[model samples]
Target: MKGFKFAGIHAGIKKNDQKDLGLIYCEKPSVAAALFTRNKVIAAPVILGKEKIKIGVCRAVLANSGNANCFTGNQGIEDARACSKMVADCLDIEEDHVLVSSTGVIGANLPMDKFKTGVPDVVQQLSEDNVDQFADAILTTDTCRKIVNRSATIDNKKFSIMGIAKGSGMIRPDMATMLAYICTDIHISADDLNKCLSAANEKSFNRITVDGDTSTNDTLMAMASGTSEAQINDAGSKKIFQDMLDDVCFELAKMVVKDGEGATKLAQIIIKGAQTKKDAFKAAEAIAHSNLVKTAIYGEDPNWGRITAAVGRSGAHVVPEKIDLYFDDQALVLKGDWQGTEAEKKTSQIMKNSEITITLDLNLGQETDSFLFCDFSENYVKINADYRS
Candidate 1:
């Protein structure tokens, strides 16, 4: 944290005249790990970044929002490389030592004039205390900044981890629909860092959904500078670090869902008593991604039928009559039967709040899983439909 410098600036790429460029630079090379979207039609920066992260060390990262460099074919790749090379030449680092990422509207060409003008200003203004500005620069439709920081002790040595992310729409994640950067001061090998990062993302980013549409550009990168010298070289140490990293990523992931565009309610879809853990997650995600369920939450309508229907179509084995559902503490359906007028009233009031929970019990086994999601509103449609305009 002491040696890392961050900066953000408005480069005239974003139409709103807000900051859309960011940089995170280390005085020296740092061990890095990253995850990108599994979508076949990926962005140019993501394709370039995968190769850079394979080098195991990176000196700086350049990211831009409001114009994703995807689907422009070979020109897109050239543009992405040009951005990185510009940073490398200016910072005196090798081009391969610089990583690049982009977010926002896809299939558009990058504005080279902005990069030629903005990158230098950002480099000049870089400082150790610009974490907030860096977080703000990577946003697309996000309503607020998402950040999490933690300090942990391993082998009597203390280390710090800080992460920031931006994504609010086009958010059904294969890796994650946005971009995130996590920095730590711990000493861990690149292989170990990648292992820990992949494990952490699977259970956190893979479980959440907003609109069920994955983006063409998505990346999550983690860097450990070994500044703390808290060596995590053994299996035991690796497990501990992995757990802590998962907790950090999971919190930040939920923050993305809670701040989802046009979202007025945060909903937790809990599926329990399934015969298998896979079934639990499938059922939970299906419910979370359902438009009917989201609209119901938006209107403060305690529609238990939508919940049951989603569960049934989730392809999970379940007996409807044996199932139970709840909206908050109000049991809307008990033993798969409507709990009547009083329960409906309670659920209606619960939906009016900013946060709500829907629990489904299969009454089969103990396997369970849950997902964090937000309700769909008119704003979500308006934001994405008119995004480029």
Candidate 2:
């Protein structure tokens, strides 16, 4: 935050009046690390970002919403590059020092004219206080911006880390989720920053789902400005930085789910006591992505059978008779046996809460994994039905 300036402007690319262009400018060239979508058909910006991030140093980020630069063949890359040039020229930095990103409707060419006019104006408005605007500009169907910050102190030297994210739907990530950008003022090498980010992401962005659709333009990146003079050359300092990074990333990830399109409830799916971590994750992923399970939560229905069926079909090694399920502390199924109508009624009450946890005890080995997700609603359908109109 000390070395970063941000801006967001209405570029007129979106149908409404919301800001469509965003910028993140670092006063000094900063160490950078990035992860992209696992979707084979990635957007042009992702292709370019993969190349740019290899240098491990960046001066700026140019991102736009409402027009995902995907599937436009060679032209898409050119457009993404051209947009980067606009920011670089305006900021008086080398073109290669700028990273680019986009989100919104897929397979459409960027309206270069909108960017042509919008880029310069947005760049002129950059300031350290403009991060909220930058957050807004990167959103698609998200109801609100997601931002989290944490601080680490070592020997009285303090450093701050800030994370900003934009996502609502198409939120499952194989490696990265939606569009997340992290900035910190800690003095750390690019390799060290990459290691910390990779670890933090596995526990955060990689564990959330909305509609189970991975975006073509998913990106998670971090930049370290070294402005705070808090070096991480040793394990002790690194651990402090890692803890702060993890908390910021996890909080932003939860905000993304809570603001998910048409979502009314935020829930954590925990698969505990599994034979292997893989099996735990497999069952949790299945339950998180199941429409029946999500809709049942939305309707406050005590439909434990949907949850049972999902775990059974998840390909996870499980002893059917050894499974126990609960909504919060109210057990709906105990050792594969229903707790009956009275318990169902109480479980229904748990489901009505804005936030709750679903725990599945496999009664197997000690390995376990978890996921964060939100309930599905008819508004989710309505929101996506005319997303392009």
Candidate 3:
């Protein structure tokens, strides 16, 4: 809340001459936690952030776009280290007290000269009013800025959490879909902060998909400044802060789905009455990632066969005769039997909306899970194919 400074600057690393650098500074050592992509081929910044966060307290974060610094092996690691060290030197903090993140073309080397010129300017421009710039500077294909904030009270104390994220492609569950940075003034231990962040990611960032591709540079960072002086060690305060944080992250996650590159519709796929939570996820993800299903949604075609086929192959122990399906509020299938043409017409209308909800009830057990996804479009293919050009 107080004494927080953030800055964003154009570092000339991107080919388009966009602002590709950002930094966040907290006056005091803040409790810090981070989650990186589960992809085995990780980026350079992820490797460095993982080690820096082990110190349990962080005073600054440095991020860059346009080059992922991945696939270069040992050189990538050295670049990450050197960048963080540069930021530390400018801020007069320990090298381990600063974290770094990068997103862009994978397997390319970073231009260290960009860091030499940008880190010092970032340090000089740090201010409380530039949080939005930091949020916008980290984007790749994002169409608009994504940010969400919330405030809550536990006992007589109040706290606030604000988060910014960017992801329009290369999104899948394994961890965060893309980059997310969350900051709060709540007082919580680094251990507790990590715990809450993991729990929240499971139900939020980990449950979304776009193109079913996981990135090598996904990173989620949360910093708790303890500025509110409200100790979250107690159960009540912990619950309040965790709920607030989860809500903020969930909002950002949904925003990612809605902004999926060239996406025409945002979809909520719910699989219910499965034998287990894992089964539900299997069914949901299978449908969400299917090119046929996504293309159908894009065309506004209520094709039930594609949906059923996805469920059958999901390995969810689905019994075709016992399943029920709905597109939005339109019931297309009853007890696995297709309704008449009238119902099909109504469901087609439902699929045409900007936001659509599809439900599949297995009629097996009470277990249920949902995944958020976006419809595939021609623009998505064009954007990725010509990304570098």
Candidate 4:
């Protein structure tokens, strides 16, 4: 955090005059690791960033909203390169060391003229105090900025980790549904940092769903400035850094789910007592992505049948007779049978809360998994239907 500067500005990329461009610059080249969307139709920046991240070092990151710069053929790649080069030229750094990201409506070309005129001014406004602005500038439909900070000490040496993310819809977490940038002041190897990021992502971004759609420009990246001089070479120090990183990413991921487009309830689907962790995850993911389950939650209905149907079709190992289901602490189904209208009434009340948990016990083994998701509503449909208009 100490060696980084942030900036956000309205570069005319967005028609509403909102801040659409953001920058994060480190005083020196920092060790970097990144994860990108698994979707084959990726944005130009995602393609370029993946190649540049292979070197494990970066000096700055430039991100823009309001244009995904995808499906534009070779011109999209040229525009992405031009944007990165402009940032490199303004900051006197190598173009390869400057990474780029973009989000918003897909299949659009980037406005190079905006970058040609605004890059210098945006660079001039960079400061350590502008992190909030940078967070806001990366958003598309996100109602609020998601930022988190955590610290840890190892061997009497202190380190700081900070992250910012933006997501509201088109979130299914194939690799992070939206853009997130993390900065740390600890010294660590790029390989170690990558391992830490992947582990953290599995429990955080990879476990959340909103609309079940993976965007073309999903990315999550981390950089270590090594300004703290706290070396994380040994196993003990690495564990400490990884734990702190996981907490930050988890909190940001929760924020993304909480701010899901037109979502009023945040629900956690837990699948337990499975034959394998993979089976549990499969079942939980199915329940999380089911529109029927989501709408039932939105309407405060204890629709246990929809949940069971989703789990049964999930392809996970399951014994219908051994299943048990609960809404929060109230039982809706016991031993694979509906608990009657009285139990359904209680579960309905529980679903009325802003946050609720739906637990399913397979009664097969000890393996368990869970996913964070949100309720579906008519507003979600409206928001996406007219998003570009």
Candidate 5:
């Protein structure tokens, strides 16, 4: 967390009068890596960020909510660049060193006047303790902050990693959802940092789904300040750092799913014994993304049939009679056979919890994969129905 200062301020971008602008300033030009949305129609900030991150260095990050600078064509890119330049001017840093991101209502223009004045104001308010404000500023429908911190000892030296993210809808795999920024005090190479981030993201952000819809403004990035002498060079040091990074990303990813728009319960979908990792992912994601299964979860119904049906159409290699299913530890189906009324009763009780795990065994091979999802509810429909209003 050293060398990183944060700030968030109300910039009039959001009509509701909440803090809509966030900034993170690193004292030094830190090594950086990033990932952006795979959506064909990318956002303006994402387009600029994809280029800026290629410099493999960053000094500041400017983000805003309530206006996704997307589909504005050339004007959006110009606006994003103009905002980046504004922040760079205030911080006395290169415009290229300031990576930008925007979220919330898409296909609309950013309130340039807000950035015209808010830029200098937020820069003036920068503080090392304003992470909470920054976290709050980036949230849309998220009910709370998705921030996580972890520490590791590398080469007898201690290092810290902090992650912050905001995503409550338009969530699915590929490049994942919304925006995430990671800061670490450990020394690392750009290549290694990218590797760690991509690997960790695969098992975390890329493994979660809320509505099975990807966003146009998705971005994930990491910055290493090197203020701490702890470095990652060898395999052992890299592994330790990788583990901590995974923990931080996964925790944030789970928070996004749990705080999903109008979600009341979080579910873990596990698919095992597949012939390949692709097959495993297909099965797990299919179940997680299935509206029928999600609604069943929300209703606290032990409808094991919905889960099996999802897998059947998942395009994964599966044998009809070889499947087994369970809700938590309660087995509802054994070798594709109903375990009986007692099992359904037990599973129904389990589903009533705020969090539950659904496991399906393909009994095929060794591959396995899992996904985090939230139950589909009436409130979810209502929230999205009026999201723009």
Candidate 6:
């Protein structure tokens, strides 16, 4: 966390005077790597940041919420560029050294006048203790800010990794309307950092789902300041750094799901004994994305039929008679046959908990995969319906 400064302020981008702008700056240019949304309709900041990050060096990250800065054509791109330039000029850094990100409703333009007046003040207020404020500023519908810290010691050298993320809805496996900024004090190359970020992301962001929607503004960026004196140039040291980074990202991802809009329960769908790992993930994703299954979980109903039906249509190779299901270790179905009313009663009780695991086994092969998701509730519908209001 050292060598990094953060600032968050109300830049008039949101209507309620909430903090809508956040800045993360390093003492010097740092090795940077990033991943953006896979959505075809990408946002303006994403288009610009994608090119800047390819240079593998960055000194600052500027983000805003409440206006997505998407679909406004050339003006949106110019606005993103102008914002980056403002931050760069204020901080005495190159415009290309700054990465920009925005999240909120689609089809709205960024209010450049706000950034024109606010970026300088934000730069002046940057402090190491304001990370919580930055985290809050990046949120749109998220109920709480997600921040995670991790440290690792390798060969007597200590390294710190801190990550902040914001998300509540429009979530899916390919990423969500989420924005994650990760900063570390370790010394590592951009290539190695990218490898670590991608690998960590696969097990974290890529496995979480809220409403099965991938946002156009989804992004996860990582920067290493090289302040720890720990050179992660070897396999063993790289593994240590990767593991710590993975832990930070995984914790943040879980926070996003736990704070999912109108979410009452966090469920882990574990698929095992599939014909292949891909098939396992397919079945898990299908079950996790099922509205019927999510609503049943919300209502504490042990609807095994919905689960099996989702898996059957997931295109995953499975023998119906060889399937088994469990709700938090309580068997609901054995070899594709219902265990009856008593089992359902116990499974329903399991669903009452804030967190539960749904495990499915296809007695067909040995590959497996898992996904983290949340239950759907009436409030979710209400939240989206009144989002713009």
Cα deviation of 240, candidate 3, in Å: 0.9
Report every candidate's CA lDDT. Answer: 0.89, 0.93, 0.90, 0.94, 0.94, 0.93
Candidate 5 residue lDDT tens string, 133-252: 999999998889889999879878999999999999999997866999999999999999999999999989999999999999999999999999999889999999999999999999
Q: Model 3 TM-score?
A: 0.98
Model 3 CA deviation exceeding 4 Å by range: none
**Cα TM-score per model:** 0.97, 0.98, 0.98, 0.99, 0.99, 0.99
Question: What is the Cα-based TM-score of model 5?
Answer: 0.99
Worst 10 residues of 5 by lDDT: 168-177
Better of 4 and 6 by lDDT: 4
Per-residue lDDT over 1-389 for candidate 2, one digit per residue giving the tens place of the 0 to 100 score: 79999999998999899999999999999999999999999999999999999999999999999999999899999999999999999999999999999999998999999999999999999999999999999998988988988887887898999999999999984876679999999899899999999999999899999999999999999999999968897899889999999999999999999998999999999999999889998999999999999999999998988998999999999898999999999998888899899999999889889999999999999989999999999999999999998
RMSD of 4: 0.8
* Residue 260 in model 6: lDDT: 93
Candidate 6, residues 256-305, lDDT tens digits: the string is 99999999999999999999988999999999999999999999999899
1-389 in candidate 3: lDDT tens per residue?
46578988898889886678999899889999999999999888898888878878989989888888989789999989998899889988888889998988987899999889989988998998998888778888888889898987777777889988989899999899679988999888899999999989998999999899999999999998888866787887788888888899999999999999999999999999999988999999999999999999999988899999999999888999999999877889989899989999999888879999999999999999999999999999999998877
Model 4 lDDT per residue over 280-373, tens place: 9999999999999999999998889999999999999999999999998998888888889899888878988999999999999999999999
* Candidate 2 steric clashes: 0
Off by over 4 Å in 5: none
Local lDDT at 282 for model 6: 97
Candidate 1 residue 60 Cα shift, in angstroms, is: 1.1
| Residue 222 local lDDT, model 5 | 97
